[model samples]
Target: MTPMLLVMVAIGGTDILFALDSIPAIFGLTQNVYLVFTATAFSLLGLRQLYFLIDGLLDRLIYLSYGLAAILGFIGVKLVLHALHENNVPFINNGQPVDVVEIGTGVSLAVIIGVLAVTVLASLTSARGKAQNAVAAARRHAAEYLDMAKDPIRRADIFGKLLAEQAKIRALPEKYRAQIREEQELMALLHRAHAEHGSTSAR
Candidate 1:
């Protein structure tokens, strides 16, 4: 199959897996079937909007993966504790319910929200995150400038953004700046964009 078809297939498979994985989390939060159905439906429907909303900010959210992992881990532990509390196995805890603390839904929601808030705050404030965002934005703007080379007006705007990002990168720590310079592909893209912009300006 074509590359685009392959990409579509891969994305479809991933979405299916994501949906399946989320079902447990939904049930863990609430057992109401109607709520679960609506939640799943809306999540699926909002996937496109969600993608657009975070596409530019994804690189900036450096701690997002860690936060998500923490959330999932907390939920997993909560589920296990819940299972232990309702234990009915013949050999496990003598088939009696264990006296374990079950996490309340309200507490779980608060922890999830709090963890997300802190994660976003930390990511946006860290020096490393700032450097990474600058590098990513510069790279993206350079590519966009190249793609819009024929459109002088649009290219001008993108080039301006690219230069701004480059300035940010330069103002970063020497180590971070060195890392960006070491990226040969990115450097090449930036150089080509600059050359094209200069040529266009002279015309």
Candidate 2:
């Protein structure tokens, strides 16, 4: 078989699996053949678009498969319960023969909606948190570089004023602060000597 044919087969097979669970869940709703056909066809028509939508959000949609699997599994369970309820076997305790399908379908629909809401909320929260963290990190790194640049002389003095205007972004404790101060002092001493030698040469 050609590669394209194989791909088509795989996609079709997956849709069939999704339908196996969903069809039964729908049947559990209205036993009418026409309504089931109409509903299933309409749903399947829109379902194809989901693949393209998911492709656009490949990495960000990590939890999508999990959500889909859970929904499918729920439908499968409902089908099994419905089948068991219909079975009038004597071995089974003759507890009230309840029509489990409608109850199962209602419960499954609610769970699917709840899961989607939580997933969307969590994704938005995490994205906002990450963006804030990145902005803060960039500001901190900028401050560190400015501090490093402000060393040694008259030319460096301009940078010193800029650093003072901006509050220290890094909250290094006493020990590191003391070390940076010492480095600044050494740079000042070197500049002072250079200035004195230049002045003497002018004389």
Candidate 3:
């Protein structure tokens, strides 16, 4: 969709084609204009809300583009099959309609929902695992430097390196951060204790 249009352009020209097909389909089922208007209105309203819910999931679904293309292709093939079944072209099928199976609304909806659920679940699971690994790796890095040396200057050097690394890391769970900070504070106290001892022994 275009971010903005110089003119209205009939909802970017696509709406016009959809309207042509939908209007006839609704009219074939019902002549009541009011019923048609309400049906279309509610459908659009529901779809708008569904789009919001699915928007964030777009990035997570790595195969979204492929999935949508597959769906559109399936619908195109079905339309082609339906057309051939009722085809009236004299040369093509001798003006006779052939029998063909149609996809039901229930089956279509179920398949769509199943695909979406699988993708979303897989994405969320992958994200969680990555986050856990990141946090674990950060903690390991911090712990490695924490107990490396007992010399005050060396310990402070290690602590400074950890601080620098911490700044580069992404957002983590608060509890993990708190634990790190607590260890850092403990290390600071140890440094101060060593400093005090050095001063007293010099006296």
Winning model by TM-score:
1
Per-residue error for 37 in candidate 3, Å, reads 6.5
Question: What TM-score number comes out for model 3?
Answer: 0.41
> What is the per-residue lDDT of model 3 for residues 1-203, given as tens digits with 9 covering 90 to 100?
56466344654344444544455444434448998787666654454455555654453455566565655555566556667777898887788876777655555556656766765565445544334334444454456554554576765565565555455334555664565456665446445545554564486
lDDT of 1 by residue, 1-203 (tens): 79999998887776666677788888778878999988887776666466666777678898999998999999999989999999999799999999999999999999999999999999888888898889889988998888884678888888899999999888999998888889999999999999988888898
* lDDT (C-alpha, whole model) for all candidates: 0.86, 0.55, 0.55
Q: What is the clash count of model 1? A: 0
Q: Which has the higher lDDT value, candidate number 1 or candidate number 3?
A: 1
Clash pairs of candidate 2?
none
What RMSD does model 2 have? Answer: 15.4
Candidate 1, superposed: residue stretches over 4 Å from native: 1-8, 52-55
Tens-digit lDDT track of model 2 for 1-203: 79999998888777666666467757755568998887777666665668866664433444556666776677667666776777676666575455554345556668878877766556445543333333333333334433443343633453344344223313444454354456564335435544543554386
Cα deviation of 108 in candidate 3 (Å)?
1.8
Which 10 consecutive positions of candidate 2 have the poorest summed lDDT?
Answer: 128-137
